[model samples]
Target: MPNDHYEAEQSVISGPKGKVRADSIQFFKFDGKSEVDPQKLAKDLEQLRAAVRQVPDVDPDERDRAVAALLAAQDAATEGDEVKVRANLKRVGKWVLNVAESIGVGVAIAVLRQVVASG
Candidate 1:
């Protein structure tokens, strides 16, 4: 299909053993910068509305329970990620402090040796 500013094309792909499949993919690329297309936006909204309507309906209490379960699961996942991040940070911090302290002690010892030799 061809329009004033947008064009669409299709292609067919053949799988292994000569199985052919037709793909109905539409590519809408603008030739130049343009304003929003109201028609396309309306069509997209309608499609979304239809999809939402297809979802199963639950009673209010059941819906609340489902929402609570989802929130609990999300909180658990977040906490798990946070725990892992903190553990890794703590491990890295410990290694860094160890390295820093070793360097500090070496520098102190070298300074003391220099002072004693000068005296």
Candidate 2:
């Protein structure tokens, strides 16, 4: 009798991560986060979606327009949207610094309160 208990799985080379295991790979995917694979076009679209989701009662037409604009921006990026990309990078850097500063201040306040309670 032939053994039928074991099945062999195959591997495929897809991206930089070579030899992708069949059981460990996903084909269709959508990450809701803004910064997925930074080089991926889908990441830009996801960022646009996240920004659109923030507005109160956003109109369908407006959302469509935004998506169109994002596509154009992606094209421009492909054609070297250097100025816009640099500006955005700078803005994000500043925003991150501000957030870190706020969190540091909050932590300092909590620590001071704890010290006061102890003393």
Candidate 3:
């Protein structure tokens, strides 16, 4: 077994008229032989949920869908299923981009990359 790592980079948009924006990136690496950490995944999902909830002037339905996607991603991650986790994360990324666009926020492009190697 080796180490498995996942990384995501996104643009965060804020400020009046969405004039301010910054790149937000995170990395998560874990021992492939061990179980994935559900708590860490849950915490990350919580933060994303909160961010969606904070966005103003977004359609209620869209917001709800985005939150649901995050929840699904969390569940997939908890199961230690890399395939499902990746799929759900892609779904969440799309929803986030839609939410950002609807709220007049700067465009957000989420790029997810994974690396696995035997140690």
lDDT of each: 0.31, 0.37, 0.51
Candidate closest to the true structure, highest TM-score = 3
Tens-digit lDDT track of model 1 for 1-119: 13334332322333343454433332222223323232332333233323323335545454344334323322432343322222222222122223324444332122223222322
Ranking by TM-score: 3, 2, 1
Candidate 3: residue 39 lDDT (0-100): 51
lDDT of 2 by residue, 8-30 (tens): 23223433434533334322112
lDDT for position 28 in model 2 = 16
Q: Which stretches of candidate 3 lie over 4 Å from their true place?
A: 1-38, 93-119
Candidate 3 least-lDDT 10 residues: 110-119
Model 3 pairs whose backbones collide:
none
Tell me which of candidates 1 and 3 scores higher on TM-score: 3
Which structure is stronger by lDDT: 2 or 3?
Answer: 3
Residue 70 C-alpha lDDT in model 3: 71
Q: Write the number of the candidate with greater lDDT, choosing between 1 and 2.
A: 2
* Candidate order by decreasing lDDT: 3, 2, 1
Candidate 1: give the clashing pairs: none
